[model samples]
Target: MPRSHVALACLVAIFWGLNFLAIHASLEQFPPLFLVALRFTLMALPALLFVPRPQVPLRWLVGYGLGFGTLQFLGLYSGMAAGFPTGLASLVLQASAPFTVLLGAVLLRERLTARRALGIGVAVAGLVLVGISRGGAGAWWPFWLVVLGAFGWAIGNISSRLAAPPRPLELTMWMAIVPPIPMLALSLLLEGPRRITDSLADSLTAQAVPAWIGLAYTIVFGTIVGSGIWVWLMTKHPAGVVAPFSMLVPVVGITAAWLVLGESPHLLEIIGGALVVGGVLWSGRLVAARGAADPAGPVDVGDPGASAHAVEPAAR
Candidate 1:
């Protein structure tokens, strides 16, 4: 990789790493689904104007949008709000990588490399360790739920790859259009009219500055800037090269949570997190090297939506 591309890729990692803090902050103020809806609403408005719709068939485009946009985030936000720790959420969500490989093997009839198979094994083992260490707690289910969110993202990744929209950024923007309504509907259905009304009333009554600011950051930084840069990078580079850096998010997420939110992981969680990330990184590097050597090989690197299968609809 060129030095400039390397630098840009690292910057993209930072943007995504910091996004956990953004999500944690936003969740503090707004209910998960409602806040997520508000987020997409903010994301879609201006983007709808500047980002042209892709020339792809409407079915594929819409499928890409709904899968990646609506289902993925819905599962993610719900998991986080339900008490999935930010750091673990970041780590476990990486389940999407293996999920994507599996999906590709099944759906696209893609062959799996040995390294990918080994990587998946190591990652699953690490996840088991992490789960065992963290359980017997208040919110363990959300952690698993977020893992589901990662799966959802993997599914979305496959959809995007199969769909092959004309313009990735435009496709990303169009995907943004699908999430808000479904999220809002879910919010209303589950959170209910009274609770939603009450939460809004409380926010308005208190004039919660943090809530508003957090919302802005999620929309501007997490959604537009973070995801937009990610989509741009995916267009430029191989997905495998780009995707491994997502492991760095937990490093950032945990540290930020410790400093900002005063949340710290146990020693076991820390060690497990290290194993999970390092193993994935090693596997991803192997995958990249293989791709570079084989020009005719099917490319499945750096998909941002790689975790779609793990992400459940409610969890996002």
Candidate 2:
């Protein structure tokens, strides 16, 4: 990969890392489902008008939306609201890599490499440590909910691969159309209409300024600009080259949360995070390093066993 594309990948990682902080801040003002509803609503509008619909079947599009947009955010936002720390939530979400590997092996009939299997084991151990460290800190259910969200993300990855849309970004944008209404209905049923109204009302108040800023960051930087750059980078370089950069997301997420939100992880949590990061790197290092050495080799985007690191936006 060129130095410039590497820099752009790092930038996207930063935006995704900062996304956790924004979610944490925004959750203070909006209920999880309601906030997600608003997010997709913002994502779908205006841009949806300008961007042509992706040339894919409706089933794949809807599957991508439900898995990625609806289920993933629904679980993640709720988990954050349920007191999953910003930094840890970011690290835990890296579970998606392992989850994606396992799912692809089973559903997509992709072979599970020894490295990937080992990576999954190491990451699962790290996740166990994370659960142990955080078990007493807060409600355990939320942590599991976030894991569920990670699984949702893995499901979305499979959907994306299956859809194989010509334009990944447009698929992402068009898929944005699926979540808001369903999420809004969920918010009404669970959070109640009165609470939703009150939250919207709170958005107009001075105290909600941070929430609004967070929303803007998520909509503008996180979704539009960040994803656009990601798509461009994916086109420019092999997915193997671009995907490893996502590993930096947790580093950025942890650091930004500590600096901005004053949320620091416990020593054990840090150790566990290290294990998780190490596992992912170990899994991808072989393929990515090979790709780096032979830049002209054809890249395999479909083989999750070999190209797990090449997938775009594992935690997005």
Candidate number with greatest TM-score: 2
| Alpha-carbon runs more than 4 Å astray in model 2 | 1-8, 228-245, 297-316
- Model 1 over residues 1-316: C-alpha lDDT tens digits? 3445556666766766677777877677788889878887877887788777776556656665676667667778889888778866777777766776677667645545677667667867777778887675656777777777777777666666554554666767777787888889999999988877777777764556677777777666665666566655544544445555666767777777788878888777887887777777777776556556655332553333333223322222
Give per-residue CA lDDT, model 2, range 144-244, as digits (tens): 88888877776766666655666778877887899999999999999999999999987998999999899989987887787667655544443333444
Per-candidate TM equals 0.83, 0.87
lDDT score, residue 160, model 2?
Answer: 67
CA shift of 155, model 1, Å: 1.7
